[model samples]
Target: MKKNLIMSFVLSTLLVTVLSGCGAASKSTTGTADDTKAPAATTTTKSEKSTTLRIGYQKYGTVNFLKANGELDKALKEKGITIQWTEFPGGPQLLEAMNVGSIDVGHTGEAPPIFAQAAGTPLVYLGHEPASPASEAILIPEKSEIKSVAELKGKKVALNKGSNVHYLLVKQLEKAGLKYEDIQVVFLPPADARAAFEKGSVDAWVIWDPFFSAAETSAKAKILADGKDTVANHEFYLATRNYAENNKETVKIVLDQLAKVDTWSKDHPKELAETLSPQLGIDVPSLERAAKRRAYGIQPIDDALINEQQKIADTFFKLGLIPKEIKVKDAVLPATK
Candidate 1:
């Protein structure tokens, strides 16, 4: 009977050992399964890469107001994007930088884009400001007797070549029954033109404000014609095609901030002038006059707008300003909606 009991105890001890070993192996298998899930969790949620936005702006554009107010910096900070601002004298220079891929986006007058497109620059029109027809004009000496655009014939007219005012001069001369070849177009920048005007060197000056207002206030200047009867006088925002395609969301943010500033400026013209006076180096009254003449609404580029721009392009081509015929819509982006 003692031998029987000893055999039963050995069987029970072996059974316990086998059960414990099975339990440990099962636990090891479960741990291996858990280890396999960690990689998938890592794959599902990856870290986002950082980005940068480089913008080119002119001294007197809406982008300048955006920079001064710090709206763009605040809006883009959370997206891990940095803002780099560079200033140019005018839209042509700004778009020149854009063509070289140095600037991601910029603001320019309408005619600059037309010329840029003619030159085969791959730019995209992002948005535009409403037409401020009276914002630009053709000025003669206040005491001069050139009463009509007709009198500008055979006279030296000072203006920036390929500028928005260039279109104005073309259209106005046409309306006055004068051919472009009738007048000698003098290509000079605003400052040089101003000096020539003061010295009575150029018979007339075609320019925009606050420079226009400054000329009027500082000297005797008279407006022969304003854009009200000639052109839309629209301001455009342009981006390179590559950047627009890659950074649509960042571009949307930029447009949103500009819209906000546009609204604010329209509501508070006096304050806008006060803010811009120091930056533009013009007096408050002149800036105020300019602010009033400015169109403060932002609109997306549409097919109709592209058609209008195409007309400008064709006009420039016919006038021998651009090399060949080009389509404005080819350099345009879809609405940011």
Candidate 2:
């Protein structure tokens, strides 16, 4: 399959990255690639010797808002660091870019990082936004007779593999007293999954916002179950271990600016959707609906959160989605004092 081949290429690229001891790419926000630029050596405390800070972001979340605000850019510029913004289709691909040293830090949901860490990608848990369990859900067609998660057994469900919604699907099934094998899972990206759901090729689709919000507004998809009782569905920010270790000051600057964005976003509820809609290509109403339930305030990774990540890792390994077991703590950076 084309998807399989693409993944194979990504894996091969990662192997070459690790083998060559090559540092991350210094690609600017433009399409240009700068493989010759390695990280600058840290000179002294608070110097943050790095000149360019590469970042990866998906269609949604903290970095996008932060970049748009330009406050982080101002702060980092004071420290002599500029940001390279690279967009990825999803968390897995973003982390793949991270593994290939394409970017330094990126944001993702709960499950992708577990898979990334399991594969031995040298990434560290940086920080997290507050949990928004209502952001993701198991959605059915507008008129489908299927009314509950239990009814989904034996039906085809579509979702992006190794995603936050993947675990949402799993936990929701268990709450319904069903096993992982109870349904047919079609692993597709958000766009393809949306198409499949619209065509009725799949009985239900598991997904997160703003896609979840878009579905409700556009297709009238019914929620069989949201993450509410099933999962935390926290959004996390991650960086390569090397990036975090050598450029701790730069990392702190990024998180600090994120905190500012969170405050402004929380205080301006209606504006959240209005501001993001243009970039996201979704209507303001849907973006508003999705943003309403999401909480703000980015916090450092803690043991309580680490335990939850561990549970996700254990569940994936049990389902044989991952080849081996992993420890969430192993990839975590200690909290900044």
Candidate 3:
């Protein structure tokens, strides 16, 4: 009886030892699984934090307002992203930066993108700026008697080629029942156009923005016609397809911030002018006038807008401004639903 009890106790002890060892092995296996998952979690966290976005803009536009307020940078900083801002003189120059991948996104008037698209640039239109017809016009000296665009025939017309004003000139000529060949086209940038206009080197000058306001105030220029008679004068915001596709969150943040700035500008025109005067080195009143004439808003590039742009492209191609027919819809962002 004593031997049987001792044997039973030994059997029970061995069984308990074997069960405890199995439990410890199971716990070790669980710990190893947890260690394997930890690296994947770390990698996911690092990936979420590794993105940076770059944006490009110009002076005297909605992007400037967004940049000045720092709202975009603030919104992006919350997402563990950084925004790099670059400024250009005009839309053509901005598109130039975009073509070379120096900028991921940019804003420009309707004409620059058409020109770039015609040249086979790989840019996608992300959005459209609110249309403002009064912001663009053809101006002549106040004392001049060139009453109509028809009189511009055989005269040297100063315009920024491939700029928004280029479209204005073309449309105005067509309105007057004249061909583009009827006029002596002199392609001058805004600054040079101003100098030429002031020196009486050009019979007429087509321009936009602070320059238009400056010429109206300082140079006593008379408006031959405004863009209202020609085109809608819409500005476009564009990004590279690769950048926009890869960075959707960043683009949304940017568009949201820009929309906010547009709303703020509409409510506070005088304050906006006061804010921009010193920055642009232009007078407050001039900036104020320009601000009122300028429309500020951000809108997605939809099918309608793309079709309208296509019409402009078609016009340019027919007039030989663009070398070939361009399908504007192809350059719209893929996520443009």
Candidate 4:
């Protein structure tokens, strides 16, 4: 009986040991499964973190329409991405922000980038906006008899130097067979130029956009000449060289969103004007008129575009607006297939 009891105790001890070992093995297997899943979880977290894109834009353009619609922000959010929008007063200011790495992408007219490029600012042309000539013009007061570009030869012409209107003025003068020196050029911001025009301080104003439209309606200014005969007057989408190379995926997203906005602007001109009116503090009627005249599409940056830009650079150089000639091709991003 003593032997049997001892045998029973031994058996009990062995069974307990086996059970504990099995429990530990099961825990080990579970822990390994969890360890394997960690990498995938980490990868997903990294992807989520990369989805935020920063974009910069100015008022008085299709970007405003995009901002008002809010579709882009929603679309990006679904892809685990967020968009941060920043606004500037105009293209020149936006390009300046881009130059300093404050902005990732923005739009500007033909002249601002040329001036920026000549200054050796680090930027790249990502895309082109379709040509819009009617949006920019040289304006004279209603009662003024400045019928031809030549009539303003000796008069002081107000323009934003280094802006697209500057190029327009130069080209128009050249077309009239007059030197840029023949006219007294006054460099003024849009606000100051408007005030000067109202106060009868400026003989003529060469300008663009809502301001041009405003001057035409409110100031009773007559169009001396539109950009039609002289310049392509197309706007450009520019990005910093570093930002574009580092964040191609983000760049593509921004471009795609911009194209969508361009489409919307074309389809809903009146609605766009109403949507933007409150934001810009401009009347809807004027915005509608300006919207009608502007282009609403995107084009890839290519050789033909570059050639057009090169002509602008050459003109600026000849007029001594820029210190040296800049090759537009060198500043353009590589063609995307």
Q: lDDT for model 4, on a 0 to 1 scale? A: 0.77
lDDT of 4 at 179: 93
Residue 79, candidate 3: Cα error in Å is 2.6
* Candidate 4 runs further than 4 Å off: 1-52, 79-81
Worst 10 residues of 1 by lDDT: 36-45
lDDT tens per residue, model 2, 1-337: 9999999999999997674553342223522343344333232333345677878777768787887677887898888787777766678877776776677888999999999988888889989998899999999999999978999889999999888899999999999999999999999989899999999999999999889999999999999899997799999999888778888788888998899898888778568788888877889989888878888999878889999999999999999999999998999876531
Error of 4 at 226 (Å): 0.4
Write out the backbone clash pairs for model 3.
none
Q: Model 2, residue 207: what's the lDDT?
A: 91
lDDT order of candidates, top first:
2, 1, 3, 4
Any runs in candidate 3 off by more than 4 Å, and if so which?
1-51
- What does candidate 1's lDDT look like per residue over 1-337, in tens digits? 9999999999999998754442121111111132211010011112332266767777576887897788788788888787767666567766666665556788988899998888877789999999888989999998899999998889999998888899999999999999999999999878789999999999999998778888887886898999996799999988888778777788889999999999998878789888988866888877777888889888988887888899999999998999999978678755542
Task: Give residue 231's lDDT in candidate 4 (0 to 100).
Answer: 87
TM-score of every candidate: 0.83, 0.86, 0.82, 0.82
Rate residue 198 of model 1 by lDDT: 92
lDDT of 4 by residue, 1-337 (tens): 9999999999999987754442121111111132111011011121233454546566687666776788777777777766556665556656655555455567788999999899887889888789999899999988897789988889999987688898899889989989999989998878889889888898999999988998887888899999996888998888777667766776777789889889878878789899988877888888899999988798898778888888999988987889998887888767541
Quality of model 1 by C-alpha lDDT = 0.79
**What's model 2's TM-score?**
0.86
* Global lDDT scores for all candidate models: 0.79, 0.83, 0.77, 0.77
The local lDDT score (0 to 100) that residue 224 gets in candidate 1 is: 92
lDDT-superior candidate, 1 or 4: 1
Which predicted model would earn the best lDDT? Answer: 2
